[model samples]
Target: MAASGAVEPGAAAATAAPSPAPAQAPAPEHLFRPISAEDEEQQPTEIESLCMNCYRNGTTRLLLTKVPFFREIIVSSFSCEHCGWNNTEIHSAGRIQDQGVRYALTVRTQEDMNREVVKTDSATTSIPELDFEIPAFTQKGALTTVEGLISRAISGLEQDQPTRRANEEAVAERIDEFIVRLKELKRVASPFTLIIDDPSGNSFVENPHAPQKDHALVITHYNRTVQQEEMLGLQAEAPEEKPEEEDLRNEVLQFNTNCPECNAPAQTNMKLVQIPHFKEVIIMATNCDCCGHRTNEVKSGGAVEPLGTRITFHITHPSDLTRDVLKVTKNPFTLGDSSNPGQMEKLREFSQKLDQILEGNVKAHFIMNDPAGNSYLQNVYAPEDDPEMKVEHYKRTFDQNEELGLNDMKTEGYETGLAPQR
Candidate 1:
């Protein structure tokens, strides 16, 4: 055996330390080479760099540009000759915001989908009508149009869930159908809602009706929950458990109610929840243990306001049908069971005419009369100069208020809220 500290004469060469390789100069900041005006103008400053994938030298181009509505951004494009790898990325110079924003619009026409949108990585998108949603963490933001956003979503699903499509033909077909419908929405053949909820507030939807308050776009700012803040690396305190969500064993109220469908006693569960902007609403739900019957209803617990209001909107395009129109009225303004027969007949005629407007068969007016002043027609923002669109607000008359039971009733010598006649 060889001595522990001894090396053979021929082994000296094999054990020698190799010389350190010379360091390579850092690649130029810009991919193209910059040329002076005297030599050749508009020459690109090309920079040779190693391919990120194959670790070989590659050519890259970096351009700094200020895009309209997007501020300044660095657009970097690179291509590798070794492995044929090409990549492009855009970096925004804008500062990241602490609070998030949400932009929602009803896409009803081809023009609506063409509006430019800027989405950041820290944004979540969803189309509730299609039952599709994408989380923020999974997205790398892009400045694209509404149609581009849908295309990106379809491409991602196809790439990420290859096995799912191969194994389940039915599921794959369903996804294909959904993709077709998504494309149709871009062509104005179908209407759908596009919602972008960004916790980073870096997403934007171009105002279709600019320089005016009336537009179909809505911008809402929401507070992030503790869990959401933590996910976004924001400083947040540990949230305390709410009493309602705590274990039922420690609760005092009886949740088991009766099933309305099956008439089963104590077979239902009820809960009252307060929605944002809207007041308390009771959700009564029950599943029958004997018959498997289920039933549920949502009822508002808030009182109706006294004032009455009227709203009107013009329908010029098929997309206008998708606008949310809410009519809130008291018993007198509404055609209910207590309404006179003639009033109900007139309401029926009105409803038929309104249906015609929604069908785009007529460029008629959409008038909503609410005696309670608690109704809204969201995103009816057509400019006054728009020939095809208009919005009008009307105040309720005293007689209308009286019919709605919102006016004071007078007796022989007394009025409502006054002392009775002696």
Candidate 2:
């Protein structure tokens, strides 16, 4: 072959592929460089990029891996095939020198937008100490003024008779109206307090235009305590007790009387009798001693008498509805013409209306005005058909007796002319 024509050097060798050279070792500079202070300082000390929702930066692109009841974080810096996003892994090797320094990315079960976990710096690091104390509210004494007096009076009046004879609905409406008016008055007299005396049951508004008087005097006069003393004298006077004979005369009958009919022995016998033009009936019980027969009949004579036919009229000043009925025998009054039948009819109508209103079946309000510009509103209710009134009367009588220092027999009985026969 060498003699064949001065063989072209390396021509056949070039036509054949050269054998692969032994793998060359990588240069030392190509490997990772050791961490240095300058590298640590130059490294991103602050987060440069963050997951928009969670606000954490650990990777260039986060791969969302869903797990059962939880989310998974894949830390490899690989492009996500599903999302087509490139990722870069964060290395703390240059920045953190201590082995204790750790970097972790947590994937919470809850979505970043839905939940937030706040990590607060310690109080010693950030929060300042504070001293807290409750503030005190001081109350001043009530104002002394005519307006104050008026407000107090109105409040006391309403408080003393909170319930009206009107039906519940009507009463509620009236209460609302009254409250509105009270609020207006309160606004007009700011910073003043109104005190009500429900127990005294006497209330009146002082007229600012009128001459100012001492509050104590006004209260005493309004309550009629002073007037009462002057007219009725001091309440210390001893009350007179009924004599013993009156008690014997008024004693209730216990035994059954002899029967006028068939004298047979009877245990239960009672009859009711009606009276003409009266609201009350009478009952009587009788019995026969000889034949053991008993009978009872209501007697017309035993019926309750009608209330006094004579109606008196008097101009009343503003006063509390709960006050005791004043004895106005000496007070000035204008007599209505008793002879005028028409006037009497009107009076009857008025009384009927009042009665209906009091019975809670009708709604009405009474506003009485005196010539002196004083006014009063009275809310009355029909008397309950209860025996408790009688009991109360007896108790009052007993109290009066004790106050008078009367003996039991004298206090319990007095001659009242055969018990007035009813």
Candidate 3:
């Protein structure tokens, strides 16, 4: 193959051989030969090709080069002289690596953003500080810099809608602000981390703090997740797909447990239910056939929602009981008398009190605090400006954060004149 080079060698002239059987040498496969030298400078070779966009004749230049902490790479560039269009691609000259690779670099300055990165199609890029991630499926592999990656993400951010599902537009605006901050990092020294995780092991980031100590960079090896392996077609066998019914069935073994209300031995039933958009939940219940008493509740599937939610309703009249109310809980509760003789009396009494509140004899407030956005309450009678009854929805609070297991942040103490010695 011809390479992008300054000098083109001419065809060798055949010299007449005097020997009876002339010694022959095979022709070279490449148009431009690679030469070894102390400086190790190689020439680029140019070849003619069709324009990818316009389909017109163009010239493609190929150059072989080495990068800092990476093997040889082929730089292939195309320029259509007729259409004034051009593009470039980089390919590794080395074999596929064995293990998945993760490259992380702390970008502290504008110069740090300029460091080169070779990303493959199987790579996912992320910036934890910005809460931004570019999934492998959504991005194309490219030889770019940290700044280039951030710029591409910014472009995608601008395409989000001005209005979206409740709270989505606000989120997009926040992302826009974050992208602007990233752009400002190009002119300032704000520190951030750039990470590239590739399952195919075809991606690389310039490492300046390695054996050569060219820059501050860290490289790590990791095993790919099942999903990642499947995405990269590295799975040796396809995973079995369980039937929907099988997933819905509760496989828990029945156990004898005492009822919290009656302190009587009861059988407990537990199973997992997959909730759409919300998450999986474990529905558990216990019933005392003797007392006709039953209790049920739900537990979350172990994922935290992005924000907390609060719901409140006021019961002012008997008509409010007729209004539709949706209460989706793992545990199902009822406000009624029980036929079982062993049923707990406190639960029966509470049921009666709830009925009294619904009858308007005792005005009460119904409130539900859920961070997972899994519960709902409807207010069909209230108008937009209703004064007597109102529905309030607000963001999650610090206490909610604590409940969701995300409130572990610790800040440094402010120094004062207080003595430190005991």
Candidate 4:
């Protein structure tokens, strides 16, 4: 065989030096160069994309968690490391499988897990921004349906038919002027929500439509007091009086009585006595004989009751006299069929004074206790200390008196008052 182009193995291998391989002619400058404006413009802009399964192909994927309700569509360009290829994927709402089910399950599970994890982590996520606007509803002219009309009426916006017609021409002129003004300003206005509170503390909220120019009038209606306005004319005016009018008026009053205990030319002194026991005041007069003796005993000539050792006055407004008498009988201090005579008298006197001041529109009553002791005038009610009368003991006495009618009790009362006709 002729010399074959093959080297003999292990036959003194030729020690020939090997030539160096050529250096990669420094990669063309353009190959490693920064992008040019022209090239960039021609090149498709790179976008990050993600694969749902891997979730790692892109630099970063937008988490569309904030707007989950809206379809989450992420447009990204990803270079697949495993396949050595580049492509774009749009993970849209439709691409998401079992979205509803996954959302429900994952949201609940993730929320619970996140709550636990967040407790340990100090990082706080920012809240999503909400961009929303409320719609404006404004209408001019009469509303169409009955519901619309009713709503307008309740809000005090709709005027009566006659009033509306009467003011139509004027209102039209005003509306034209308003429209012109509004056009000049280039603004849209809505109905005012009028909030009003009444004297009774009830509040109302209403939306009333009127020209913005007429809003002042609408607000005035809310500020007006209907009930108080009606009474403005009827309110009483203060009366001017002379300085000594009260004293002169009191000095002219007279009473007829004699101290039966001393029988020594008695003079009666009237006073307005306030009773703390009953929370009332009475016009009571006592007769003093100037011999260290006094008595409220008296003879009745007019509507007044007979002389009692102790007298009391009941005062009340004239308008309340009848009602008070009926109420007093049912009061806690009533003695048998009658109320406390002293308290009743005081109520009567108070009522009388109120009647005089109110021109018979008020009334009062009067009562009296022992005039000798200051207890009656001092607001101290002690039935045990009085020999002639014992309110505390009268409960037992009146129980027996109930057996005797008024006529029978009067006969017994005449016997107790006489001094043997000496």
- RMSD values for the candidates in order, in angstroms, are 25.3, 46.7, 29.3, 44.1
Name the 10 consecutive residues with the lowest summed lDDT in model 4.
Answer: 115-124
Candidate 3 residue-wise lDDT, 261-353, digit = tens: 333457998787776434577788888755456888777745655655566777788876764433212111111121122223444555567
Question: Against the true structure, what is each candidate's TM-score?
Answer: 0.44, 0.14, 0.41, 0.14
lDDT of 4 by residue, 73-170 (tens): 22333354653443322222111111111010011121122111100001111101111111111211110222222232222222232354476867
lDDT of 1 by residue, 1-422 (tens): 11121111121221111221221222222322222233243243366776656677778665543343334444455677777766544444444454678888888878788887777666778888877777665655466789888777666555534665779878767666766776666677767788999876667787644323436777777777777777767677566555654343243334554443223444545566655443555666766665476766665545555455566777787787775443222222233232345545555666666666767888867677776655545543332244543334456688776655555754344545666655
Residues 185-281, model 2: lDDT tens digits: 4344323222222111212222211122323222211233343333322343455663464443344334332233332333444333333333323
What does candidate 2 score on TM? 0.14
What is the Cα-based lDDT of residue 400 in candidate 3? Answer: 71
Error of 1 at 385 (Å): 35
lDDT for model 4, please: 0.28
Question: What is the lDDT for 299 in model 3?
Answer: 74
Index of the highest-TM-score prediction = 1
